[model samples]
Target chain A: MKLMVSVKRVVDYNVRIQVKPDGSGVVTDGVKMSMNPFDEIAMEEALRIKEAGNAEEIIAVTIGEQKAQEQLRTALAMGADRAIHVEVDEDIQPLTAARVLKALADKEQPGMVLLGKQAIDDDQGQTGQMLAALWDRPQATFASKVDLDGQKAKVTREVDAGLETIEVDLPAVVTTDLRLNEPRYVKLPDIMKAKKKPIDTTSLADLGVEAAPGLKVTNTAPPPERQGGKKVESVDELVSELKNRGLI
Target chain B: MAKVLLIADHDGENLNPTTPKAVACAADFSPEALDVAVFVSGDNGVADQAAKLDGVSRVLRIDNPANEHCLAAMLAPQIVKMAADYTHVLVAGSTFGKDLMARVAALLGVLQVSDIMKVESDYVFQRPIYAGNAITTVEAPSDQVLCGTVRAASYQAAGEGNSASVEDISVDAELPDHTRFVSVETHKSDRPDLQTAPRVVSGGRGVGSGENFDIIYKLADKINAGVGASRAAVDAGYVPNDMQVGQTGKIIAPELYIAVGISGAIQHWAGIKDAGTIVAINKDEEAPIFEVADLGLVADLFDAVPELEQKLG
Candidate 1:
């Protein structure tokens, strides 16, 4: 069996977010960039599957500028055999990215597709499920646990209350959640070997997908800032305030 | 010139809060531009809520026993077929909404825009990226079968007290044959809806012990608020994972958010940034939580807890 994991290069999770002056987008100049948090989990899940002998090949894929290849190599440094680049500029629409992925996925025909539940940058969480639907396949979203058994696959999703396990047929899409597993740092030897790994490059146009404009934004602004609350001197005062407000 | 179809996600019978909230977002996007109709896969009661929400033109009631659970495998195909007749589709990012939205968009050969905070027009949506660090304005190209998932807590339901035209239809859907529901175990908790609650009180590693985690809960109960926790608190077993409010946990946009003993990690702040008011209580005034907090109290949680319990009691 084979596995395809999608990762994105985005603003580092640790950096503070700031909006641009023109407000078209956020400030990225001189800021840190790294692999998406969920994608890291997806890559780690693929690595775990490969280690379990369930996967023969693990190809890391990303859709963005050339810097995305570095993110892909991070996956390779961890354990993937090779990588693929659906090369495109930044600010690519989810549908367009999905179309490019569809083209690559059709050619690769991997038995499984793994992705982070949402990219740390976009947090859309739509690509994997969309891919599954576009290919006429089943999908398990926000998977906390995934286990493959024979022809059937079992997955536990992170629901509102707790884990909700569902079983689907093979050749399905699975998105990773927080509790899935922690990603490991690439060792020195693996990092050295990743430089020699081969990555196939493809274009969005080659995928036969035409970019048609759909949604447009009229305006953008930050959410309302929280107001200040005065502190009560004692719990008795708080309880009285609560009672006056009918909260108690 | 196609109409609209919304997969009414009422968790079987009752209309889930998201269903009405999605209607409000669709209303904001394009009122009367599309014929908004809701399709409930489970209970016909969802048909009952069609009247209460704004912007709904009709309700498609599919009372099928096979539509027992809102499983993605079972509901996606039906939504795909229903989507073919609609120009746009809207679903919330709630548990059932996210799954159905992805499946419906997939069946229609389109990808959905998830957790859209606001929609300005037919073609553009404003969504947060980089874990709420940045916002991106995206334009979806010519695909008319638009699929969107709205954040449940961000919008209000349409004003109640109106009835919608309900129509019952039998769709010879390519019924889902696979994907079995093993069994459901509904773990009950006393916590309010994390996303929609107006007031929230959260804890972190500073709370120190699992047994002591009740401080936040007690504080929340006093104010008719919900309880949340940082990823650290959840990871430390101080609280269940559901209470976690961070990048990967639950995202809450409450009216008032009080952080007790939380140092305010960026990941945790991402989930609560939309909170209307923020109060951070920590011994270390230099904690990151203080940067965004509207009020910072430089006091140990231990001193604050008993004081809170006593005053609020």
Candidate 2:
């Protein structure tokens, strides 16, 4: 079985994002970029599945500018067999990204396509489900645990109320949540080996997928800030204040 | 004329509060007609409950065995089948909404406006990106039907007053057997649900252990508040992940939020930033949680929680 894991290059999780002054967008110039944290978990799950002899040949794919190949290299170092970079210099929305992935899925015909539930950059958790819908396949999203059996995958999903277990047939789309698994650290030796791994680059035009029309960002702004109140003297004072405010 | 179709989120027995909040968002734009689609396995009263929400015009219930569990695979096609009569489709931004709406959008060949924090116009919205670090105003194309997931925490629930009529509508779409619901494991807690609770009391790593969370629960019970935990506490195995409140967890907007021993991370702040009044109790005076807290108390949680509980009693 083959596993295709999708990753994205985004502003580092630790960086405090700032909107551009002119309302163009968030400041990304010279910002630290890394593979989305959840995608790392997805890649880690794929590697574990292969290590358990449940699958073979993990293909790491990304849709971004040339710099995104850096994340694909990181995926290669983390145990992906090869990489596919859909070279698009423009910012791709979820719909366009799903179209690109669907094109690749048609070419690869992998048994399962894995992705992060949402990108830390956009925080729009849509691409995986969109891909499943376009491809007319099953989707198991927000998965914390994924077990692959013969032509079936039983997934434990993280939901609002609690955990929900579902069974989906093969050739499905699975999105990873935070508690799925902690990603493995890329070793120095593996990094050097990844340098020699082959990456197949393609463009949206070549794949017969035009960038889909989507939402237009009109402006960007900082969220409203909360003003801090004075500290209370003690727990007694806190209770008194709560009562005074009719909050208790 | 925008005919809006809002999807109702429920537990097969009761309508989730998120549904009414989504209704409020839909009502904000003042669409020509706001109809709700309730998909259930049988004669669940969810449809009737949805009919009572103020501003709801009609309740369209789709009864099917495949809808016993909200599987996105089965629900998306049915929604798309009924898409022709509506100009917009809306759902709550819970796990269920985020999981299901995108598939519906894809099937309709349109892009989705996720987590709509503000509805500026019929076709424009403002949503948080970079995990609430920035907000972006976006304009969806008006030529096609719009799909959106409402941030329930950002709006008030639609009050129950008008008794809209309910209609049983069957969708002629093929339901797939590829996805099957197995089981769900929910915490059997009588405490108010964290998402809809008027008050929430959350603990952090400083709470020490899972056993120590009992005090946090006791304090919450005093005020009839819901119990939550920081990602740190959840990661430390002090509580279940479902109790987690952070960027990756439940975003709630209660009347009041009490943070105990939580040195707030940016991600955690994203979840509670919409809260009305925030109170922080931490031993470290410089904890970041205090920066946003309306009231701060620097004290050991072990000592302060017990003292506060006694005082409230």
**Top TM-score hit:** 2
Itemize residue pairs with steric clashes in candidate 2: none
Candidate 2 regions exceeding 4 Å error are: none
What is candidate 1's lDDT per residue for A179-201, written digit by digit as tens? Answer: 89989988999989999999888
Residue A242 accuracy (lDDT) in model 1? 50
Per-residue lDDT of candidate 2, residues A1-248 (tens digit): 89999999999999988889898999999999999999999999999999999887999999999999999999999999999999998898899999999999999999999999999988999999999999999999999999988999999999887899999999999999999999999999999999999999999999999888978998999998788888998998999899999998
Please state the Cα-based DockQ of model 2 relative to the true two-chain complex. 0.88
* i-RMSD per candidate, Å: 3.2, 0.8
Q: Can you write out model 2's per-residue Cα lDDT over B259-296, one digit (the tens) per residue? A: 99999999899889999899999999989999989999
lDDT, candidate 1, equals: 0.76
Candidate 2, residue B89: Cα displacement in angstroms equals 0.6
Quick one: how many clashes does candidate 2 have?
0
The count of backbone overlaps in candidate 1 is 18
